[model samples]
Target: MVGLYMVPPDNAVVLSVDEKTQMQALDRTQPLLPMRPGQIARRTHDYTRHGTASLYAAFDVATGKVLGSVTQQHRGADFVRFLEKIDRTLPRRRALHLVLDNSSTHKTPEVTAWLAAHPRFTLHFTPTSASWLNAVEGWFAQLERRAVRRGSFTSVSDLRSELRRFIAAHNKYAAKPFVWTQPADVILDSVARASRAMRINSAGH
Candidate 1:
């Protein structure tokens, strides 16, 4: 099944996988401040330390759905765990095409061997340093803006709970396909211009 997100209705699933790191588990029991005039607000500079965890997230581009797991490590094994979760997200019969970056964990021999064995699942790597090409990166940015940045959790479990809550809340009413605002020709033209400029500069040396 190809043209997963663009053609047909749910014939295929496009899963974008990635990992976010160094999430500190901070505990702040108090409620966040509401916007008000002359409100200096309050924040805990030093929160109770409950260790940290790396979030391995998978987003379904077509459905606006997300599946995530938090662990202390972001390695191949952890990525495999996220893959298992992705499997659980979609039904057994449908095919899944994964879009991901070429992180070391993603290209380990074990992962390659696993993919080799599972012909039904295909992995597509985004261009190097072009993670923005992955739809899930946008979802991650939303997660950071809403549930992660400047947010505090009392413990690892609390962090997990908050993420679960955020996902649940999001699934309740959030679903939109990303529109391609820029045409392919426009992008190609921009790239060609940059390449021409680079070549001219190099010839001067």
Candidate 2:
């Protein structure tokens, strides 16, 4: 809920947690043309795909600090490991309240047991097709624009290293906290319109 995102800073620590999966290592066919005065930067449309990597992250809503982990596969086990990493990184006294989407992995038996064991952790799930409520997605957009989009990597390992470096730099320097500006009613209206359009399209077919 929007209220969870808007919770007071002094309250429980709110984290927007999610996984950015299958990020590709794409090398442009030709070198990119760097930007100058009047012209914009450009790159070849075609690319060579080395492989893909998955990133699990928890973005602190109040502090703008991120706890991240990279994985070769996106699985419930990996998600649990990331949760354990979060549990270790954050201060033991501060309770964590996570905003997540309706991903099945988030509710697996492993994750449920972990949450049951850790009373300090709470979860707030966004409605279907409404993950934009999670602040982590905004952080992800920054990663895409600043690193992954125009990046050139030869292998999945190289890409993973660069991703880790980016995460480190982000916590050190780019603590740009994202504010939730849209009202819940506005978002619900948008989703309603989209659902209607999809229903109309499906009925026509």
Candidate 3:
């Protein structure tokens, strides 16, 4: 998968596909405090939940553009719809390769049937417990920090609107392909060390 990130298949499009689920549409109890020269901006800790939304997004590896859908449920049917959207958005001539995690929703019979019908599309599963390999995860993190965290929403619709707006602005202005800098050997060594440390700590416990 790391190799795929560095050098994708010839004449094919690679997309990092994932869902950001249960995004709460929270409204603060009080208005935000405006920042002045000496004071930092502050928002109330207590918030009221309007609702929740799930965002399914595909991050284009070559162009760094995101095509996304907001859904009320994170079900297999909803994932299939997102796949359909990707199919419609991309050129028919190119083969599509999607990097995904092992989510139950992604492997349902409905999704399997859809993929069977779309011969041009292929799926590549990341290693278990390793979402860091998926480029879309980085994009999702950015969305959380820049847009969702400070946002005040009146309803689920408002949250969805904000998500759409953010994705559009990102594609227009901030979109860039995610770069995987660490070599395979370096990554493996780091993982091995971490595993050993975890084992040692467990033994001590």
| Each model's Cα RMSD | 4.5, 3.5, 3.7
RMSD, candidate 2, Å: 3.5
- Stretches of candidate 3 off by over 4 Å are 34-41, 188-205
Off by over 4 Å in 1: 1-10, 29-34, 37-44, 187-205
| Clash pairs detected, candidate 2 | none
Question: Model 3, range 111-170, lDDT digits (tens) per residue?
Answer: 999999999999998665566778899899899988898899989999999999999999
Q: What does the lDDT come to for candidate 3?
A: 0.89
Worst 10 residues of 2 by lDDT: 2-11
**Which of 1 and 3 is ahead in lDDT?**
3
lDDT of 1 by residue, 65-127 (tens): 777787889888778777777777678788888878878999888788777876668888765
Winning candidate number (TM-score):
3
Local accuracy by lDDT, each model: 0.73, 0.86, 0.89
Model 3 root-mean-square deviation? 3.7
Ranking by TM-score: 3, 2, 1
Better of 1 and 2 by lDDT: 2
**Residue lDDT tens for model 2, 1-205:** 5666665446478899999999999977889878889997888788999999999999988879888999998788999899899889888988888889879989999989988999988888876656667889989999999899979999999999999999999999988666767777786687576557757777999
For candidate 2, the per-residue lDDT at 169 reads: 98
